[model samples]
Target: MRAILAPLWNNAYLLMTLTCLFWAGNSVIGRAARDLVPPVGLAFWRWVLAFTLLIGVAWPYLKRDREILLKQWRWVVALGALGVGAFNTLLYSGLQYTTAINALLMQSAQPPLIMLMAFFLFRDRTGPVQIVGVLLSLVGVLVIVAGGDIDVLIHLRLNPGDAIILGAMLLWVLYSVLLRFRPPVHPLSFLAATFGIAILFITPFYVMELMAGRRIVPVAESFATIAYVGIFPSLLAYAFFNRGVELLGPGRAGVFLNLMPVFGSLLAIALLGERFTTAHAVGIGLIGIGLLLTRKA
Candidate 1:
C-alpha cells in the first residue's frame, strides 16, 4: 500500500485533483445532510474525528516539531480558525438555505481571489496567459453554473445564504494565502496541529448549536455522513491540499479549485440521476483548455 501511494504523494497535480474531488463530495454530502446534522456540530465533530484518527500517526512528528510549532503558533491558530473551523461551518450553514448550484457557483470565485490575494500579500505576479486562463476557466464555471443559459445569471438574486457562502469563500482565500507562512515541520505535524486547534476554535459554536437544540440526528445516514466527512474531506483532503500548495505554490494550486464544479456536476449526474447535457461538455472543454494554458504559462 505504501509503495502504491508513495509515488502519488509527490505528484502535486494528482494531489490537488483528489483534494477537489473529496471537497466536491463534501459539498454534496453537506447539502444532503443539512437537515440531519447541525452545521457547527458537523464541523466540530469532523475535525475532532480527524484529529483522533491522525494523532496516532502524527504523534512522533508533533513531538519532534514541538518547538517549531510553538514558534509558529499564530500561523497555526489563524489557519485553524479560518480554514477548518469557520469555512466548513459557514459552508454547511449556507447550504441549508441556498441551492447547491449557488454554492458551487460562488465557490468558483476562489481561484482568482486566491491569485489576487497572493499578489497583494506577497507580490506574487501572474502572467497574462495565466490571467486569461483563469478568466476562461471562470467562464467555463459560469457555463456549468448557468446550465448554458446566460439568463440564469441575469435572473439570480442575492440572499443571506449566498452572503454567508461568499464570506466562507473569502475566508478560504485568506487561509490559502497564509499557507506560505506555515511552520517548517512535517506535513503530518502541521495538519495534526491545525486539526486539533480547529476543534478548539469550533467548540464554542458547537456548544451554542447544541444549546439551541440543533443536534445531529441519530440515524445511519447521519453517522455515515459524519464518517465520510471526517475521513475524506477533513483528513485526506486537507492533507492532500496542503501538500499540493507546498509543491505548487498557492497561485498554481488555487487553479485546481476550478475543477470542483466540474466534478460536482458529474457527481450530481451520477448520484442524483441528473442528465448529462451539452452545457456540461462545453464547460468541461473550456475548463480543460484553461488548465492546459495555465500549466504552460
Candidate 2:
C-alpha cells in the first residue's frame, strides 16, 4: 500500500494537482463574474493584490537578488506581460462570452501547441508519439467545438470567445518556454517580480477599459471574485506550479495540466449547474489520453 501511494506523496504530483485545482476554480470565478467586473480591472487588481502580498513575504530574497533581477529585467517583463497580464486578461475577457467548460477545453490545446512552438523556436524534436498525441488532442478539441455533432463542421461555427482563449493559451505556452531564462532567485522572489511587472503592463489596458465605459463597480460579488483570484490562482497556483516545475521538470510537469479541464468542467457542473454531456466526456477522455502519451513523446 505504501509503494502504491508513494507517487501521491511526491511534492510534484501534489503541487501540480493543487495548481490545476486552483486554476479550475479561477475559471469558475472568471465566468461567474464576467458581467460584474471588467476583464482588465480584474486582471489588474488580481496582480496588484498578488504583488503586494508576495513582495511583503519575499522582500528579503528579492532585495538580496536585486542585481541579478535587474540584469534579467527583460525576461521578467516579457514573462509577466505574457503569462500574468495578457493570458489572464484574455481569459477573463473570453469568459464574458463562453462557458468555463468550453474555455478550459480550448486550453487543452496548450501542450501540443507548446511542442510545435518549441520545435520552431528551439529546434526541439518530437517523436511519433507526440505527433499522435497532438492529433488526438486536436480531434478532442474539435469535438468540443462541434458540441458532439459532426454536422456542425459543415459551417464550423465558433464562439468569439474560443478564438480569444486560443490566444490566451498560446501566450501561456510562450510564458512557460520563457521561464528558462528567469534569474535563479527564490520562487517567491520570481513571483513577486513577475506580479509587479504584470501589474505595470496591465495598468494601461485597465485605464483603457475604464475610458471605454466598462468601469468596474464596487460590489461585494466583484470584490469577492477579485479576492479569490488574487489569493488562489494568482499567488498560490503560480507558487505551486513553479515548485512543481522545479521538482518535475517542465515536460513532465506539463502532463498534469490535463487535469485542468477535468476539474474545471466538474466545478462548472457542480457550482454553475452546467450540463455534463457525452461530448464532454469523450472530448476530455481523448485529451487525457493525448496528454498521457506526451510522457513517452
Candidate 3:
C-alpha cells in the first residue's frame, strides 16, 4: 500500500481525519472528565505525557543529530511553542468553558486563516475558489456554533471558551504555515523536540495547578485513553500532519480543516452521548461546501 499509494496517498487526509477523530473524542472525554483534568492542568499534562513519549522514542535521534537540530534550535523551539504549546493550551483552556460545539466550530476557521496567512507571509496565491470555499465552511461553523439558531450569537450569549477556541484555531494555522519552513530534522526528532520543549515551557503551569490541589485522573473508560492521546493524537497526529505538509504542501492540506466538524460532531454524539440536532447537520453541510471550495487546484 505504501508503494502503490506513494503518488496519490494523502498523509494529510489521514492526519487531519485522525486529528478530528481524536479531537472529537477529546471533546467527549473533556466533558466527562472535566473535574479530573481541570482546564489548564489537562493541557499541561497532555504535553507532559507526549513529551515523555517523544523523549523515549526519539532521544537517540536527538543525540545523533544534535548538531543539525542545534543549527535550527530557534525555529524548532518557536514551532514547538506555537504548534504544541499555545495551540493545545488554548484548546484545553477553551474546553473549560465552551461546549464541544464551540470547540469544533472555532477550529473550522483554521483553513481560511492558514490560507490567508500563507499568502501574506510567504506570498502564496489565493484564487476565487479558495475564497468561496472558506466562506462556505465558515457558514457551517457558524451554524453549528450558534446551535443552528444564529439568534444565540445575536443574543450575545457566546461563551469565553469559544474565544479561546478561536485563539487555538489561529495557533493551528500559524503552526501549519510554519511547517513549510520546518528545520531539517527527522519527523520523529522534530515531534519529540516540539513536544518536549513545549512541556518544558508549560511545566510551571502544571506544577502550579498541581500545587493548587489539581490531580490528573481518568475520565474516560480507562486511563488508557490518556495513553492513546499521547501516542496517537500527540505523536502520530503531529507526524502525519507534518508529513502531509512536507509531501503535499500546506496550501492543499489546509482544506482538511473542514472535515473536523463533520467527524467531531459524529464522534461527540457517539462517544459522549451528545445529542444530535438538525442544526448540526445544516452546519456540517455548509462547512462541507465551504471546505470543498477551498481545496487546491
Candidate 4:
C-alpha cells in the first residue's frame, strides 16, 4: 500500500483534494452551527484560534523574515483581508440564510471568475481546454442549483443568501488572483502573518456582532465547531492549498475546487441523512470529467 500510494502522496492535486475536503467540512459545520454562533463571532474566533496555534510554529521564520514581511506588509494585509477576513465571514453569514448546496454552487463560479480576472489584471492566458473545463464544471454546479431541472432557473430566483455567497465567491476570486504577488516567505510565516492581519481586520465587525446582541453561545458543539475549523480548514487546509497553488499555479489549483460540492454532497448524505440522488451522481461525474480536462491542458 505504501508503494502504491508513494507517488500520489506528493502530488499537488491530492493536496488540493484534501484541502477542498476539509473546506467542505467547514461549510457543513458552519451551516449546521449557524444558530449556535453568529457568523462574525465564528469567523473571528476561528482565526483567533488558528493564529494562536500558528504563531509559535511560525515565530522562528517570522523573526528571520521580519524585514521582508514589513516591507511587504500592505500586500500581506490585502491577502489577509480578502482571503481570510471577508471570504470566511461572508461565507458563514451566507450559510445563515442559505443551504450549503446553494452556497457551494455559487462558489463553483470561482474558476471562471479567476480566469477572467487573471486575463484582465495579469494578462494571463487561459487555453481553450481550460475554458471548456471551467464551463463543464459550472454546468455541473448549475445542475445542483437548479435541482436537475433547467426550467427551475427560468424563474430567475434571487435570494439574500445566494447574493451573499456570490459576494463571498468574488472576494475569494480576487484573493486567488492576488496570490500571485505573495512574497517568498515560509508558508508558516505567511499563514501567521495573514491570520494576524485577518483577525485585526475582522475585529471591528466582530465587535459589532457583539454590540448587536449576537453572541456565540458557549456550548460544547459551538466550541467543537470552532476548534475543527481552526485546526483543519484554517491551518492545515490553508497550508495544503497554498502549497498546491505554489506547485500548480492558481488557475490549475482552482480546478480542484470543483470537488467541493462532491465532498459536500457526500458529507450531507453521511451526516445529515440527505438523499443521494441521480442529480448528484451526474453532477459529480461532470465535475470529475471537468477536472480531467483541466489536467489535459
lDDT of 3 by residue, 22-102 (tens): 665666666666666666666666777877767876888888877887898888888998888888777777777887655
Find the 10 residues in a row with the least total lDDT in model 1.
95-104
Every model's TM-score: 0.98, 0.84, 0.85, 0.94
Model 1 lDDT, residue 191, Cα: 92
What TM-score does prediction 2 earn? 0.84
Provide the overall lDDT of each model, using Cα atoms, as 2-decimal numbers.
0.92, 0.79, 0.73, 0.88
For model 4, the stretches where C-alpha displacement exceeds 4 angstroms are: 1-10
Report the lDDT tens digits of candidate 2 across residue range 1-297.
Answer: 979755654667788888989998998888878888988899999998888778877999899888998998888889888988999999999888875546755676666666666678787667788678667766776665566887766764468988898889888888876676778987888999888888888889998999999977788998999999999998989988877766755545665676777777678679879798897789778877876676566
Candidate 2: lDDT over CA atoms? 0.79
Clash number for model 2? 0
Q: What is the TM-score ranking, best to worst? A: 1, 4, 3, 2
Give the range of the ten consecutive residues with the poorest summed lDDT in model 2: 248-257
lDDT by residue for model 4 (1-297), tens: 879865654688888999999999999999999999999999999999999998987999999988998999989999999999999999999899986656776778788888888889989888899889988988887776566887776775558988988999999998888898888998888999999999999999999989999998988999999999999999989988888888877888898888888888889899989888888888888888888898888
lDDT by residue (1-297, candidate 1, tens digit) is: 999998889999899999999999999999999999899988888998899999999999999999999998999999989998899999988988898778888999999999999999899989999998888899999999899999999998878899999999999999999999999999999999999888998899888889998988999999999999999998999999999999888888899899999999999999999999999999999988888888888
Query: Residue 94 CA error for candidate 3 (Å)?
Result: 2.1
Q: List the residue pairs that clash in candidate 4.
A: none
Q: After aligning candidate 4 to the native by TM-score, how far in Å is the CA of 284 from where it should be?
A: 0.9
Cα lDDT, model 3, residue 194:
84
